[model samples]
Target: MQRFDGRVALVTAAAQGIGAAVARRIAAEGGSVIVTDLQEDKVAELAAELGDRALAVRVDVTSRADLDAAVAAGVERFGRLDLLVNNAGACVVTAMPEDTTAEEWHRQLDLTLVSAAQSIQAALPHLLKTRGNVVTISSVNGLAAFGNLEYSAAKAGQLAMTQNFAARFGSSGVRFNVVAPGTIRTPNWDNQPDALDRLAKLYPLGRVGEPEDIAAAVAFLGSDDAAWITGHTLPVEGGVLTGPSALDLTPKGPFRKEQ
Candidate 1:
């Protein structure tokens, strides 16, 4: 739609998956994008593919210095920043509460929650200058208990962080929001057999999501179309949260079977 013509966006973890999709979408819409990831080669390849519309930077999102450098490089290249997509995150560990160690929990929070906050901190000055907005990649895990305790908690915290920032920065014309995705076919599930098929049963849409699904929603929120939208968590989960209940659909209808 060329909604982003002449704008510049910085997207974290842009080497692949949803992050890469976001970078492609933004660039396709005529935005100059700064794509950051720890995988230098892949990030560079993406930037190359995007041609002059993109710049690649290797960044460890947990490191404040790295984030500052990436932001500086983006501003230096683009002249100003119009959007920040905090897509760098991981579900480092997945275990039952009792099986999850304190260290693992901290690691998850550090990767998913703390790093997003830090990225916002690094980009706030530029955002304030341009009256830009932030669109963070959260998950359906955050809104409901879908297992992965640590990841869920961290994702939930991202939503809260976005809301708080939106409230505080609205006066400055800076907006913050989140896109909570359901089971998307990403590299993380490459090891699993038929994972997308199995996950699709839980969603009313009869299929799991693609990276482009989430990217489309992020594009909408990041565009001028969403100028009046902020502090909202948009669920791009293939109707997972609103799907019919299995128990209710059962022959017994939420009751025990005949003994």
Candidate 2:
């Protein structure tokens, strides 16, 4: 359980939801983490909650300066960096796809894909020394057709980026991987309670994912437990990738149990 003992990690967008869950999981496993997010006060609260093992820094992942400072602060506080969890992405496109402006597209990519790449660049030098790894939070939308076109594209970009980084730095003992999750009950879905309920029916597991669900996968990929793993996308979805009809159960699934 203490797989992260003596390790230090940097987690972006750690104020809430999946990000906070991942940070907590690492800290629970005896790792130190630098938690960053645009919500300064929220991150500060999270840092306080995690006590000495965590540090809170305000980071607008879209801002390279903030990203760099966050990385530096972690290294300064913890000595060395081992893992970078890129979880600072969102679905910002509100307009129709055809009507979406180039500026909006830029903003979307900059927030999701570019931020992840930038964080990697900032953490690479330190990761090299520790022979550490990165675990990016992508989405199933990247693997299949989802309504958020821009977000899906950015998520897909993460997969390719991880693979290339893994290949380029594999010899140096650096690893890169991604966790693609299905619908998770985050604060974003707080207002859409019915949406979550409806989405759950589509999942073979009978429920949408939780932030902790994704967090567990991140822990595995970031720790030495996955020393031989690299450049892979582990879908942390609850069997949704198999399609709801792909299974049989008393409920949640369409297929019935054999008599």
Instruction: Estimate TM-scores for all models.
Output: 0.93, 0.94
TM-score for candidate 1, residues paired by index? 0.93
Instruction: For residues 180-216, write the lDDT of model 2, one tens digit per residue.
Output: 9999999999887799988888898889999999999
Clash-forming residue pairs, model 2: none
Model 1 lDDT, residue 98, Cα: 83
What residue pairs are clashing in model 1? none
- Give the C-alpha lDDT of model 2: 0.92
Tell me the lDDT of model 2 at 247.
Answer: 37
Model 2: residues with Cα > 4 Å off, grouped in runs = 246-259
